[model samples]
Target: MENKIKLLYMLQTLDLKLMDLEEEKGDLPGIVQNLNDQINELQAQIDELRKQINEHTSTREQSNLDAETLNQRVESLKKQLYEVRNNKEYDAITKEIAEAEENIMAKMQNAEEHDDKQKELSANVDELKQKYESLQSELQDNQKDLQEVSKVHEDEELQLKHERDKIARQLPQETLVSYDRIRSAKYGKAVVPITRGACGGCYKTVPPQLNLLLRKNDEILHCENCGRILIAEEIAAEVNKVA
Candidate 1:
């Protein structure tokens, strides 16, 4: 009975260590994925800004061409005004010249506005690219750190798991099943020692008769309140000494 109790304790300790190792590894994958997602999103924004800049540049060029065409039309109308045959023809040429001048002014204004928008879009793209590069560097560093940590813990976790399996194999089938069930239900504590004539798991006082039986270590005992396997304090001390 003493040996069985000690084996359970050892198994529990190994299982707890394995759980801790798993927890350490669990968050790394998600963190890496989130970083990659951020980098991708930033890159997309950069691309969109670049596209907008291209569109604005094309529109600006078209406006400039339109302004040039209207200016040429105004010059031709002025030449025609000098050759007009009468006041009616002179007034018609003047009216045409006025309309062309107005169009030229409107096109030049539109081109200037497009130029300003293009500059703004280009600046935005540059800023987004810089942010993307910084995020990429951060992601690489995180990946390297995660790799180092995994390499360090892999062997230790494997050895602990092997030790836990060996100890479990040495325990009785019924006892092993009960221990696993209770450990799962009780957050990884299946066996507990009596402390101050009370259940160590639940901190409830044990009856005098039950406490006396627990101290004997002749038979497997369980705490009635929490259903955890009970071991005598002396038995726990002896196990620790041997370890």
Candidate 2:
């Protein structure tokens, strides 16, 4: 139990050091991540608009081709009108001509509609692309700033994390889980040593009985007020020296 207490303290120390290193970078990481998300959303929108534009272009092309075929059919039907010998035959040729002309008009109208939509989608894509570029530029700047700050603590932070992992592995799974939970709840401070017979985290006075038991380091104990684990000052000092 005493060994477990010491290991937890060492783990907390390494974790705290790692936290400090990350804090030195300020809000650059968050800013860069936000910019990246914005750029990605904009890119997706641009891609969708481009796809719509392509579909519209294909529809317009097909409409134009259909209109051209109808026009040719109308011309052929008109030439057949001159060779018709009976009134019935003449009427049929003229009817075919009229229908083909009507189809040509419809197809041309459809082409015009698709062309207009294509132009609108193209404009939207251009607008989104500009926004994407602006966000991408901002992301690059923030990323560069974050990179510079991270580079300063890169090796030290890695070393601390490696040490933390080792110490954490030495602790029981239940103890480690509780420590992590408390740390997350209490702003990255899971274990604190007693100071002047008081809780180091919340400054609440420790009861004499609990303080005495803490010195034994035989069991995990938490502060009633802040719920952070309490350790003996002597154990903290010893761990600090070797950690």
Candidate 3:
């Protein structure tokens, strides 16, 4: 192949490397987004648990107030019993006292039930809080890990970009432009090595005469099937050493 094509092959190699590094760096942002989503979900669950605990506490307190009001009503009925004169009046006061006492008992039972529910809800909230703390810690660690990976990737990407720039300086502008166009068209693979009389880019059979000329290294050979510039192994090995 011509020296320009050989250089183009080298340029293609650098393009592939840069493409790989850029792809890895691109994935980092999505990974960070997923981590943040998980953290948000955990936070939302924690908030919901807190709201439940608050509601249960409020219910318990309200039940206790209802029980206290019932207790006062029972005391007032007892006082009425002491002031009554007639037998009928006495019976009426006794019935009122009984009814008031029953109401107080019912209210006390309701209060206890509410208190028990509050205890259960509070325990659940504590457990949820512990889970949230553990998840938060994991999220933070993952975020730190993502940051470290991103920094490392950025450094590597910068190095690869510097290398590509240096190689571009050594290559002609037209050749580099062709290299970029083909690299993008071929999914970051603008060059392929010929092996066993076949185009490695598309596995198509190369004509015997052209194959010989390819071996002579007089001109660049592109695969008819895939349109990628081809490099013979021996020439590639020599050039690789120089590179």
Candidate 4:
């Protein structure tokens, strides 16, 4: 019974260490993914801004062409005013010139607005490009760090798992199942020592008879409060000596 309890304690310790190592590695993948997500989002924003800038540039160019054509029409109408046959014809040519000039002015104003918008969009794109670059660099760094950590811990993690498996195989199947169930339900603490005449797991006072039985190490004893396997001080000392 004492040897079995010692094996159980050793197994629990190994399992806990393995769990900690796994937790350490688990965060790296999430960190890499989050960095990638941020990079993608920034790239999307940059693309949308670039699209807007291109549209504005095309509109500005079209406006410029329209204004040029209207200006040419106005010039032609002014020439026709000199060749008019009467006051009515001259007045009609003059009116046409004025309307063409007004249209040209509107088109020029629209072109200027588009130019301003294009500048604004260009600035925004530049800012986003910088941000994107920064995020990309950060992503690369995180990936590198993750690789380094994995490389560093790979052997140790494997050895720990190997040891845990070996220890687990030594225990009876039912005992192994019970240990796992209790560890899962109690946050990785299936076996605990009696500390200060109380259950180490739940800090509950142990009955005198139960304490006496635990010290005898004749059989397995469970804490009444937390259902964790309780080991006596002498048994724990023997286990530590073997460890």
Alpha-carbon lDDT, every model:
0.85, 0.88, 0.75, 0.85
Error of 1 at 159 (Å): 11
Q: Which stretches of candidate 1 lie above 4 Å from their native place?
A: 1-20, 153-243
- Estimate, for each residue in 1-243, the C-alpha lDDT of model 4 and write its tens digit: 327777888888778777887687778788889989888898888889889999999999999999998888888887877788999988888888888888888999999999999999899888888888888888888899888877877898899888888877787899989988998999999999888899989999999899998766547789999999998877677666765
Q: Top lDDT: which candidate number?
A: 2
lDDT of 3 by residue, 6-101 (tens): 766666666676677657655656666776787678678768867876777777678778878878887887888888889999998788878877
RMSD of each: 7.8, 2.2, 8.3, 6.8
Query: In model 4, where do residues sit more than 4 Å from their true spots?
Result: 1-19, 155-243
Query: Which candidate has the top score in TM-score?
Result: 2
RMSD of 3: 8.3
Candidate 3 stretches with Cα past 4 Å from truth are 1-19, 22-35, 155-243
Instruction: Report the C-alpha lDDT of model 2 over 51-106, residue by residue, as the tens digit.
Output: 88899999999999999988888888888888889999998888888888888989
**Lowest lDDT 10-residue stretch of candidate 2:** 1-10
Q: Which pairs of residues collide in model 1?
A: none
Worst 10 residues of 3 by lDDT: 1-10
Model 1 alpha-carbon miss at residue 116, Å: 0.5
TM-score quality measure for candidate 2? 0.89
Better of 2 and 3 by lDDT: 2
Tens digit of per-residue lDDT, candidate 1, span 89-158: 9998898888888888899999999999999888888888888888898899889988988898989988
